[model samples]
Target chain A: MSAERQERIEARIAQLNAEMQKREDYQAIIRLQRAYGFYIDKGYWREASDLFTEDATYEQGVDGVFIGRERIHQVIVKLSGGNPGPGLPFGQLYERFQLQPVITVSDDGQSAFGRWHELAMLGQYGEHAEWGEGVYENRYRKEGGVWKISALHYFPNFVAPYEGGWAVLKPVEGDWRSPELADFPPDAPPTVNYKPFPDQFTVPFHYPHPVTGKAVA
Target chain B: MSEHLLDALEAHLDSIELRIARQASHEAIERLQRSYCYFIDKGLWTAASDLFADDATGEWGQSGVYRGKERIRSYLALRGPEGLGQGELNTHITCQAIITVADDNMSAKARWRSDNMHCTDGTGSWSEGTYENIYVNDGGVWKIASMHYYVTLICDYDKGWIAGDIPMDPPSETLPPDAPPTEVYESLPGAYLPAYHYPNPVTGEQPKKPDLPELPESGEDTLADAVAALSTRVERLEDQRACEKLQRSYGFYVDKAMWNDVSDLFVDDSTLEIGGRGVFLGKKRVLEYMGIGLGPTGPQREQVINHQQFQGIVTVAEDGKTARGRWRAFVIGGSSWAPVNWGDCLYENHYKKVDGVWVMDKLHAPFTMYTLYTDGWHKATTPNTRPESFPPPPDLAPTVVYLTYPNYYCEPFHYPNPVTGKEAPPPNPAAGGVANMADFASEES
Candidate 1:
């Protein structure tokens, strides 16, 4: 057996392992995002917040920006109807069904960005039930051998009444920011100004079309 | 050694190719079926029919069977030309599926649900159906072997279902089908369930009755199905999963403040008791209590209350008709304007199987503790909500009244403890297996 042959065999194995690891990482990052979504759905604010890095930025729709893990955690707790701690309060349904994830890992495998569609079933028992459609362009960091959210951004397309649905949805009244978070205040202004539903905003695609390999405008 | 490595590499490549081939079969069938629907949506009869194999059989509702690729094209061509006109809208959105590729990789079966809309001239109609179709691998390209489209209903766009069901036209007068209807059955009003090509993936259980006659070389149990059936644990796991799904789904519904969806989880005569607010009898009565107490229906602009259900201990009855579960919920309540609070509760719930569907028959929840998020349980505590706290009262009075937080009340378990049946309890060992620093110190040095 030649030394060159052994070297070639070893290199082939290494290549396969690297490819497999990337696929595994893709699944793991998706799992992390999905778990984060489940935590948010159940109003497990602390759990949802823990999925982020120490320094992370959280932004949703026109809700400006909240920076830092602690601040973002507080904002997550506040944004999810202001019930803090282990669980959501009774009669509040904030189901964020994480769906259709298209993830892309960087060359180093240390960072990745995922585009996900969020079909949110939001409501309060007896109050008002809303069906929300949104897209998430989130960034994740691999630190300490675990994937965590680095920057979270969600483009809310619409939040319409469950009864009439999106068909009867009127345009946003103002900035679409929850009035409750007014006192908390965002660290920065919204990344972009946009209207949803009746109006249109294409949440930028993180990856190009598979076949065309052309950027999706 | 180099020869051995080369052989190993060959084996590895073979394994990868085998897995890829199976997956490719799934993708190919999905693409073929989806493309057929897309072509059909635009009245591209020739293009859609081209997807059919040389000797494929196509069945549409009560329409007689059309055999062969050319005959299939002729049948579809009855719908008119290549493409629809301006006001002539024909939209077909097909989604949700169960795809099964043969272990031999030569054949496949798929079930698809389609929602269709068609507007001819000015008259519009809606159509919905299930497609239990078959596909064959021709060399490497997959093509439709059998397309069985069982229509659920076709109704007027405005009137809907019973009020406006548009009956299926008899065999086209000019160009009739090759043969009689395969499995004749009426739409909507009739009870006709098409037999699934594959059994339950988990339990490997298929219902006793299968309506349609089998096609060639398919619908038989595969090796995976046989292996899945060998496990006695499958049925229990399936039952347990169903119960867990119910609890998780109920929790999510409540988290979004969707009482209507939450209430729908319960049976018509189900009973619910939240805290000491008393038992809310029947689904409607429970909903009435919520509608009256919680204020309105839907997402609250400022307030949020999430009853996060967790740690469910479910025990299915021997008959499998009923089940009891005990679950705990940690409540996060209040709004930005209002003071936020934390609460924990225990639930002893009962579920009953009706028409093969599991619905909550009884939801008995007992509040354990309630405290302000700012003040903490050690400092400030909120009293449990009561009957008088809300306006229109409950249907029944409190069953078991108890004090919450600063006080303790055990919510009795519905199932006996797993360890309770043990003859003896093991004594705790203090130091026998304890780690000694000296034992591992040499390795560290």
Candidate 2:
């Protein structure tokens, strides 16, 4: 083969390797997000919190951010009613359906951003049934070949009584965050000011339209 | 020196290409599984069944095992004759697909999360589930070999899963399936763990026995041979990605009622079939059909249309000229003067690469059900009826006649039993496992 041809081949090889690496990075990040969901669904708070980086930040709705892994762990433990002590009771359930994900990994392959719709059904001992919907705009980092949550933000669309549905109910307000649960307060308020259903607002998109390539402004 | 350099370059290129091909295979398989959800949601039995291999096996919801492509078709068809009737809604949205391509690149396994919302007869229900599916690369075209869904929670909209008003195992009054239930499990309130297709993604722990086959050898080859192989592999990956983007673009266009753009995604001879409304053959006719249903182009000021497509499973033919995809759509739509409506459908659609661009060759959607938002599926399940002003009506009558919800029907299957590769035995009336709405109603009363 000619020298020029060999050089061209080398360049193409480099490009292909880069693309492959990007894809693997995407897979790792998605797995990290899903692992977090599975752990939280079963009240495995410690396992869920472990999915984050040491200095990661967590925020939901109006609640301020909880910085650092320990604080994040504390928040989850409080939410799960004081850890429920390893292995949930037979009748307890917290089913969170993380659906409709649009994930974008950074060009450098070191970090990624994702937006997901969350549909949750939760209660203890089959009582106090509640239905909830929300959006998660989260950031993930690749640390030593593994992905972990760098910043987790959840915006509530609605948390309503199961019997009446969103239409007949008022939106649940305030963050679940408390000083008793975590040392750090929320990092900041929600990115946008918008009301839940019965009122309509499009959750800002992180991606352009798949077909038109038009940005959601 | 030049010869040595060439050899090194070829080796590097070959390895890169192999990696790209494996990544592409993972993506294509994930899309293929997602497409199956879309097809099954619409009740497009024929289209959905086609996604399976000739010897595929499937177990969905309460339906027992269905083996073979023909059986799969028959099972899905039972959901509705031609497709869902008007006013019924069936939406099966799937996400969180963790796909693993075998080292050989000839087989794969995937795990997915399925969230289903149904409406029929003025009543609505919600369910959450998981799927562990297998795929085979048959002569370069991937096909589903086995699919099993485990329902985690299924309950009425009003009562919810926590209420305990609904039974864990409602009897199925539909025709007996080809085989008995693979395993007995109950939805929420009764704890049951569905088997996982893979170990923990992060922990790398193998909880269940690994069913993956042995990895194929990386076969010895010359530098020239490797270069040639890598070239072909890269092209295939590019084609797969292009096809995925094309289908996703179609969904976005339809969501905003971008009629011209949607029509442009089809070839001149393409066809569009929505539920029992029948087929709109050719691009001109398809455009006309869209106008009738969606109003005159652009975004209609008074209309609110949200049609979301999820779980796209796409398989490009070995020839690379044509492809088949299964998808699920969750639709919520209404106009200023009309009541809001929500529903779901399954899409078993075809695509062809025309002039280097992928476009829809045939779009077929068979809806499971659609109902008004206020009344839900339980209270006001209305049958689909033909629109009065639409011209060039349905080319054929519905394939089957059935009611949605409060009634039991098994959508036909497209593949045979996964293990047997043989037709399932017909249900025997004397066997006595069939459960119907009446049975549940009486129990609830």
Q: What's the distance in Å from true for residue B272, model 2?
A: 41
CA error at residue B172 for candidate 2, angstroms: 32
- Residues B1-445 of candidate 2 have per-residue lDDT tens digits of 2666466555656555665777767756755665565545556566667778898998876678888988888877766775665434455667646566776778988766666656565566766666778999887778889988776556677654444224444323565567867877654544444555543222233223223222223466633444555545555555655565556556555655667667777767888877667677777777787787667675554444545555455657877898876565666555555665655555667888776667788887766446565554434444544534345575555554433322222232222322223333322221112233123222111
Alpha-carbon shift of residue B394 in model 1 (angstroms): 28
What stretches of model 1 exceed 4 Å from their correct place?
A2-6, B2-9, B17-199, B202-445
Q: What is the TM-score of chain B in candidate 2?
A: 0.48
**Among all candidates shown, the one with the greatest DockQ:** 1
| Shift of residue A23 alpha carbon in model 2, Å | 1.1
Q: How much is the lDDT of residue B406 in candidate 2? A: 25
Which digits, one per residue and each the tens of the lDDT, describe model 1 over residues B60-166?
Answer: 99889999999999999888876665445455555445677776779988876565656665566656676889999888878899999987667665444445567
DockQ of all candidate complexes: 0.07, 0.05
Q: Once model 2 is optimally superposed onto the true structure by TM-score, how far is the C-alpha of residue B151 displaced, in angstroms?
A: 18
